[model samples]
Target chain A: MTEKKTLKRFASVFLASSLIVGALAGCSSSEEGTTTTTSGGSSSGSSDSSEVIKIGANLELSGAVASYGSSIGKGAELAVEEINAAGGIDGKQIELVKVDNKSENSEATNAAIKLATQDKVTAMIAPATSGNVIATAQIANQYKIPTVTASGTAPNVTENEDGSINDYVFRTCFIDPFQGIVAANFATELGAKNVAIYADNSSDYAKGLAASFKQQIEANGGKVVAEEAYVAKDVDFKSTLTNLKSKNPEFIFIPGYYEEVGLIVKQARELGIDVPLMGADGWDSPTLVELAGKDALNNTFITNHYSSQDPEETIQGFVKAFEGKFNESPNAFHALGYDTVYFIADAIKRAGSTDGEAIQKALAETTDLSLITGTFSVDEKHNPVKSATVLEYVDGNQKFNSKVNP
Target chain B: MEWLQQLVNGISLGSIYALIALGYTMVYGIIKLINFAHGDVFMLGAFIGFYAIARWDIGFIPALIISMLLCAIIGVIIERVAYKRLRNATRIAALITAIGVSLLIEYTVIFFRGASPEAYPEVMANKSISIFGASISSQSIMILAVTIVLMILLQFIVHKTKIGKAMRAVSHDADAARLMGINVDNTISATFAIGSALAGAAGVIFGIYYTRIDPLMGVLPGLKAFVAAVLGGIGSIPGAMVGGLVLGVVETIVSAIGYSLWRDAAAFVILILILILKPSGIFGKNAREKV
Candidate 1:
């Protein structure tokens, strides 16, 4: 029995040590793979002289953010389909090589490697969220590939904190500070003297918006009555909400994603804290209605890139094409995805070559290029100089409230 | 009054931990194995209830019954298939197997339903009843009531039924139970059934109260429930119940006092303190081990 126990201990220790060593080896190997392969601009993957203009789409197709990622994929697909049918980009058909990042930062890096090194695409579309886009930023620079994001609105997505811009990274939507200021201005217009800010502490997207909103709200002569935070994936908020209710603010700004935001809104209303709650583009999902009952969403507002209900001719035409293809009306994500493709295609057309360097140059020099979401020139920071629309939730549907321009 | 409101919130949440903790305590009593997969059983129960109400159009009560029954069967199957053969193995081996079973069930659910969360269909009217300056949603009241009634039923079943007698006998000594003509395997299976049935009921209440269900939702709650089991004394039922409620209230108080960030971490701290100060748990007797 003693000998058998010794054998068992030895076997278990051996197995445990092997697992630890295996994990460390795996991490180092992947790091080496990225470093070795993501090397030089001269080794930029695509040769645009072929019959196809290869465009890679690194998206979160099947994870926590699947609804946003898949919707953007559909809109991009629609734009590509129309372009292919109408004699392609300069008669060289655009072949989109789509990769699913699974809504993970690590997976986003892997997708960037697979797209930039192996797929040999001239340019690509980054993931929907800011963190995932940032994951691919360094890889984009390494490959000299110009990647445009549909809705990555964080300032760090395009420009680093040290005031150095990501030369190859671009975004179609307005930055986070713009949305925060826009929301503060809207609150001021609503005669809001005091406000509460409920932010998602885990996400840079929410934290960024919260900081800017606080600054602009105080600037607008409004006092911040309360500020609280809840991390993503938190399901209970009654205690926190009850505490906030005691502060008695007129407006509540919950800058978080739809998953937690929906529950917060529902729980807040249940506690009878009926002040008007506002958020940013993260609330632009149809599932928000299903999660937070229609009654709970009353008087809620969100600043978005575009609203399908906007009666502009450019917006209406894109909405019609989107609904006809998918059998459902498109949300702001879809519109942004569609515009991102056009934004890149316009750069490719003006550059007159599918070469990575040529397209990157054209993108940096983009001026007055118009799409369904907006018509604007790329600023020095590669952000769009354009307008944002605010929509109000009424009877479980988004009603276009007003447009704010910057 | 504000403090009272936080207490109400804590109890509703604690009842969930209590329901799940019972399964851990019962299984540990019978087999001396911490069934780590108990939390996933709760997750499965929520999904079962979700499909029954959302897809089959079943009423709330019937759907809850269906979820509980199905989860009970899943618990029994997990025991028979994964745990039965490991009964005589070393304790570490059995514990590792339990952890393996946990990951298997979580990934299997994720395989079928993608990682995106689903909102449970509204079961009850959205209404809050206020008392003594504290507002309690009807759903919270329902969760507390269901938990208490199920716990009472568990007590009665464990004390009154022949299987309950067999379970106590087996927990005392499996060899002695066999010598006394008790079917040890069947008694263990029944313990899993009853414990998992309560967890299933808790799952439905959790869905209705929180309104978001995901495949990996079971991980954190499972660890917390395990902590509750330990705090109550690993093999003591009454200890498990009291431990869960105390932990819940303490977490809520932490958040209410404006330290919401430490809410999740507070559970593990209590667990460590309990192990050092009173390893036998609150309701457990300091019985001497027979070598």
Candidate 2:
């Protein structure tokens, strides 16, 4: 009985010590969390009288499209830091009220609500993808705030299916149909009359590109010999490639992300289908070269926001600044994101006030505003009328081919 | 000719499904537990092989052997830690725990290696061999050969070894086998080791075949392999092989006819049709409910 008592006492002592350590660990972690949130942005207490211009960034920071969202976030942060450092727009510091949408539509809506209603942000930068941007567009409009999407290329992001232009929804990049048209024109320029389209069935971005490419290619007197669709996460595209090979198209347009496109290119090449392949901004990832290999991606092209390799003075200067800030060269998404923030700041500076209505008018009237991606004016549909650079993948490197202007 | 090409593609893909199905079938046959984590084991195996080939620069055979051995050990540990105590409990409890383990493994992988996919280097020379107007890559042929060799080796161990005899006994009647001095726990662990080892091999070949490896890659393939095991008459050895081939061919054929959008749905459609038409499966014995 005496031994059992000793054992019970020891167990209680151990439990007490462990509980104390657990509490201490929890406290430190919470403190670290607070530090990160504070360092990242003023995620809390952005009231109207805060003497700072609150820019709501509803982005995909940690989900399926996290890479795009986080890249844009970094660019936006850098742009804000530069603007604040250069003496804030109209002498008021820009408080970026960043929020994560988890790459989900409903979460994006919730983020917009939290930013608009609680944080009371004046202008908002939308999600990177089209669907997430569309999901939050209605909320932004309801709040009378103009939102700029960095890379949401779908037409429906700025316009509804019924051909109604979203009054307050604006984007800093060209639409999906524009990318498809550029590829089609590029194909025609190469004198390829026979073309095939293998597009992703999962995303509106790919489907939109496919539809526009088909429309423009048929207009250019090229016949679409074979049209096929593949879902996301599919690895084996051999059977489809074999079927497509029989049709004998001279060029193939694949409007999809890097993940599936890379494997498709490799597999198609292995099957002796050596036609030139093309994709859009979705294929602008280093993962593409890794997956498709240098040889397989030899004859591919993609229409992008801007090429960092461009010798344009504005572009080179922007690239240098971005590389210095982020320790890496800026991709098309980063350029678009950086340009998006500058786009808003330019509008706010012209509007001469933090008022949403004034900023909306100034943004809609944005004309020939030179930014990192390009000098662009907002069209009636809120799409940026800018030049897209066609990048050819030669020896696994994206070589700037030519710039196409709409 | 195009049909022939599709058939080649189907067979190669089917062989992978067969390998993964073997694990599910064997684990269920021996323990009467649906090891949902079996698919995640396959994913882990691919990642292991990716590290083996990509990081360590190990040759194909050594990488294959190393991946199989490591996965076998992981399989045994999963069974010991998660499933062993629940062996006497309800089957539902063990199945849920298996699913939990599967999610844990996938997320743990995702936590370490970000969600981006890693491209597997071409370990084998990619050369096309045309037979009867149907072009087949040497990579596909190699994958088919490795799968066949593994299946044959699994057959040899299952039907010929002392451990194999012990497995058959315990699967038939665990209580009776335990009474006869058979170590049930060790036999079960061996079964997992063998099964997971095959899954590991499948993962490596899959990486070579598709050349893209990601953390969440196991979920869909796992569910499909389960469907394959069911179609093959769950718990039946030979049934899993035939079932996997049939499923692969049907999926490819569906995509070949321009219904590519319905390709993934085609697998589940077959599953439903089989369950309704042949609930006992193609090779399953019609054992009545004991209750």
Winning model by TM-score: 2
lDDT of 2 at B49: 84
Best by lDDT: 2
DockQ by candidate, in order:
0.23, 0.42
lDDT per model vs. reference = 0.85, 0.87
Evaluated on chain B only, what are the TM-scores of all the candidate structures, in order?
A: 0.98, 0.98
Scanning candidate 1 chain A in windows of ten residues, the lowest lDDT window is A32-41
Docking level for model 2: acceptable
In Å, residue A126's CA in model 2 sits off its true spot by 2.6
Give each model a TM-score.
0.88, 0.89
How many residue pairs in model 2 have overlapping backbones? Answer: 0
Interface RMSD of 1: 11.0
**Which regions of candidate 1 deviate over 4 angstroms?**
A1-56, A60-69, A80-123, A138-143, A349-359
- Tens digits of per-residue lDDT, candidate 1, A1-406, equal 9999768855654454333223222322231111111212111124554877878888878766776787788888888888878877887778777888989999999999999999888889999998999999999999999999998888899999999999899998899989999999999999999999999999888998999999999999999998988898888888888888888899999999898999999999988789999999888887798889899999999999898999999899988998898999998888888888889998999999977889988998999888888788999999989889999999999999999988
**For model 2, what fraction of the real interface contacts is kept?**
0.52
